[model samples]
Target chain A: MSKQVHRTLSESQVTAISEELNEPDWLRELRLDALQSLDELEFPDVIQTPGRTWTDLSKLDFEALVDPEGALEQKERVAPEGVEVLSFAEALEAHESLVREHFGSVVDPQENYLTALQTALFTTGTVIYVPEGVEAQAATIRTTMAGQSLFNYTLIIAEQSSSVTILERQETADEGDFDERYYSGIVELVAGENSYVQYGSLQDLTENTYNYGLKRADTDTYATANWIDCNVGSRLTKTSVETVLSGEASESQIVGAFYGHDDQHFDVDARVWHENEHTTADLVTRGVIDDEARSVYEGVQDVGRDAWNTSSYQRENTLMLSDESEADASPKLIINNHDTEASHSATVGQVDAEDLFYMKSRGVDEHLAKNMLVSGFFVPVLEEIEVEELREDLNGRIQDRLAQRTA
Target chain B: MAQLEIKNLHAKVNEDGGEEILNGVDLVVNSGEIHALMGPNGSGKSTTAKVIAGHPAYEVTDGQVLIHLDDEEFGDEEVPEELQTWELLDLEPNERAALGVFLGFQYPAEIEGVTMVNFLRTALNAKLEEREELFEGDESEDDEDDEAGYETSPMEGAADEGEIGVAEFQQLLKEKMEQLDMDEAFAQRYLNAGFSGGEKKQNEVLQAAILEPSVAVLDEIDSGLDIDRLQDVATGINALRDEQGAGILQITHYQRILDYVEPDHVHIMLDGEVVMSGDADLSVKLEEKGYDWVREEVYGTA
Candidate 1:
């Protein structure tokens, strides 16, 4: 048998990954350019900022990051027959011109270091395209890491008048050393006029693994995008949900839930920009932190100049169970125009002592009481989920996390 | 037999003005009796109930709250010296609830995430735990470990069974709502959210019937109810004493509710203390004779 392969995020690795998928030249160039820029771009000072934390990203070993090539090679798990779940290189070779035209055009690289690096060197990811006026049930991508940094991507384009839901999940089943394993990914969604796109991400990396990712979407006139993010893992993680309503009468609703335990550090930053008239957006993030874990939530809703009659609201609430657990939330609204209604509310607190006491007084143990409060914390978001199976899965994952923390 | 007693309860609110709300109010409520406290607004009727329920806003300056359960009296006196504050404040609203004290809030707090079902289960479990400690004593709790190799004792099993199941609990809510002339569908709604005045009062009565507190303090339970809703609430409260044998403390400003509920004992409260008390007729007498008689009798001037 051949030796087990270990891969790093390097120039040749990107080339090899692209070649493995037989990608075209332009796509390969994009990967190389992204890799080269990764070395030059400085990771932003996320910590010094009001809500950001200075997590030690330098300690992460990119050299030992395993590729898990076979992880995304399966055809049976193909996300819809028409959609492609291949590496960036494969997309370049098979649909070069298509990838080039739509890849970095939606999200600019100069926006941030993470966005630029993600735009260039995203080796293993998927591309989904729903042709004009043809609505598909959903496009799903499941990536499994066998002890490695399994960075994935999902690029969805809902053509004029079409609608699609994209569900991406990251999980691992490796018995190998997990202390050094990590995953970072980015997904971009572009919905054309009169189109509807709903994107959901479920993260369940190993307890020792660290995950950082970003999700950004842009909606055209008369279009809508709904984002539902459920994060239930990672020792240290940061995610950003960004949206730009560029088309008139466009709207977006972003909702998410993050449950963490132990020494987990989970950060959720949501940004919504209204650039057109009559556009509206709302974001609601609910989270639960237990044990020694910590959660940070920062949300910004901005109504751009001349984007009149735009209305936006954002709310973030977190429940901290244990004394050591900490939660921080900052919600800011910026309106450049006067004819806009922009509002935000944030609350960071512990479980209701009276509620806890009420449950305990009924003979429920302390552990069960905590679980009930946790369940209550997530019930609002879970009820908002349209899909029943996915909702059930999220509920199960939340319960599992609670069990691990109490255990 | 369970009995809750209050003696010379003196309490105050640390407002900017240093107002003393309850000034040496004395009363005795046996195991099964309905006591109606009537007076105008700000007459210290609600303060008395809040002090007994351990509300932090009110400080009990001097008083002894004795709770008798199964022939044994447990209060601040029986508790250890190290546990004085624990026996009082640390016990929490739920702990007091487990010990058979329930407050039907004059204004119920609206909580977003907690559902009525889950909230009830938690409270039921706490009450069961307190009941277990009361029955098993030390030897019985220790025997649980020896027998099952688990922490749960025999009393726990019976408590578990005695506690209503989910379906049965839903049915109970339905029955109680129907008895109160409320819509059965209201059970699924959030507790106390968007409730009108009469609805809130009726909801309190419904909770009292369901929880069956040893001492039920209905603080201003008649302030906002229409005539029909008032009658329904009164009927539901009367069932609490007639069926479940729970002691009731009906705190109200107007005697309108007493006309329907008919208190066994009626007490008149002045600035911060009870000035006069008598049988059911005192409620009508207070309405007819008014505060003039109370002022003349208690303060020696009308």
Candidate 2:
């Protein structure tokens, strides 16, 4: 692989990535359209942040990071029966007719960097489609990211009255691991009328990797989506997760937790927009920061004027372990409808001194006391994750991180 | 040979040497003996309790605190390093608690997330593990039967199956709470959170009763309690002493609790030390003459 620089999102770049993956004309057209949208749209003005520099594209080299085109690559990637997993290139060729229906529906190319990579140069992606009224026996699709500095798109659509659970785990083992690579990705989830969808993402990128991700879900006509995100890796990560209730009696639960140590910088921005009547949403996000690590979480629960009886609540809490560590929590709620109920709460501080004192008064040493307090801080978020294995794994990783900081 | 001895104890609130609060307090509380320290407000009774519990705000300028468990002596340089001495004069609060010392705070903080069951189970298991290690091999058949009893119950099956279960501990806690007349439902809620003053005091007593420390220090348990609730707390304390053999160090400004619980000895704290000692009749005398008379006659106060 050459350490060549890939500059600009042009037809050539799109063709290079598309041709390398052997993507069909439809996927190529989608990529080109997404890239055009990315070039035409402007960045959002939600917060005051520094502009994105070109150095952030170090991980998207076409020749070095991507698989060759039309290499039977999708056929080699296997998943459980009835739970299909195929790359965007394969799906664009084999199921090209249905590609237009699901691709890029949740995250528009106009919305920041979500679709820009796909628009410019998309090598591969995982497309998950659950047929109407089909329910998963267990967590169905387990998507694995194995390459270094990889950029992937995951599009999941649960048809009317269908239910499914998707768990995505990103890992790199060996020479292919790009320590300083950048991973920019997006996930689009849509639940049709009376459907239920649960998507869980575990991002444990290498210390040298920088990750930027955006995920959104649209619930229509009593549909429900439970999105659980656990971020325990990467040097710097900026993520946005949202759920839009677009139908009457639509509901969603968004649970997110991030544990960072060392010099890691992580930011999570989430928004839940209730665009229809009788919609409801629940959001709880927690972060534990140690050493010189910094974490910022910004969340908003917006209830529109047409959304009557809309109930929503957002809570963001951060526990800082070291004197040098920093955490910023801002949970905002914008309510345009007077009849709707919306509440937001944000807390940033060390563990309660009284709590520490109480635990200490019971024979638990200072270190164990802090551990117990930190564990309790994440209990609610962890409990929201229904999968036992994933929950325990998350807890173990958090405990290990805490131990390292204390050591 | 259970004894809690305080010798020439002195402490101040501020690190920069503020006013001397507990000045040369000398006292000894032995097993089966309930000693009540009676004094007026700011007489250093509460400070003595806090100092013994290893409150960080206070610095021990002089003196030592010795809590002897059976034949083992704590807080002494003479004890061997492997003997597990608390060094109460310099120990942290948890270390003191682990050393069989318990203090019922006058105002226990309402911890939000720590449930009563979780806190009590952790404290109990720590003590249980310590005792198990100490009393290995010489364990009694009754103790074995109790362990087997827990082994037989399907309730402990969850724990035996590898999950961190608290069913056995919850059962023990329920029985203890029943003794304290505390609602069993309260045990499922957050520890002392949203509890009323009387309920909070009862909670403290409940924990003391459950943990069954070698030495129990109750500060102002009688304050703000009605006669009925006072009698309930007194009954719970009496039960704990009779069953657990815990030495009671009751710090109260009123003689009302002594009327029901019946302390074996009463000490009057004037400045920081015990200024006067007498039998239970002293409580009656203090009730009749009041703290004013004691301050005037004992400390030469006008």
- List the candidates' TM-scores in order: 0.84, 0.82
Worst 10-residue lDDT window, candidate 1 chain B: B146-155
For TM-score, the strongest prediction is 1
TM-score of chain A of 2: 0.87
Considering the two chains of model 2, state its CAPRI-style docking category.
acceptable
**What is candidate 2's lDDT per residue for B31-141, written digit by digit as tens?**
678999998888899999988888777788999998766544322323344453335776667767766788888888776545677666666655554444333435643
Supply DockQ values for each candidate. 0.23, 0.24
- Give the proportion of true interface contacts each model preserves, from 0 to 1: 0.26, 0.26
DockQ of model 1 vs. true complex = 0.23
The local distance difference test score of model 1 is 0.70
Query: How does chain A of candidate 1 score by TM-score against the true chain A?
Result: 0.88
TM-score of chain B of each: 0.81, 0.84
True-vs-predicted CA distance for residue B198, candidate 1, Å: 2.7
What candidate 1 gets wrong by more than 4 Å, as runs, is A1-10, A44-94, A109-111, A116-121, A352-373, A402-407, B10-25, B39-43, B56-62, B69-92, B121-130, B137-163, B270-275, B288-296, B299-302
lDDT of all predictions = 0.70, 0.73
* Candidate 2 Cα misplacement greater than 4 A, ranges: A1-10, A20-22, A33-98, A140-144, A174-177, A405-407, B14-24, B40-43, B69-86, B109-121, B125-203, B222-232, B268-277, B285-290, B298-302
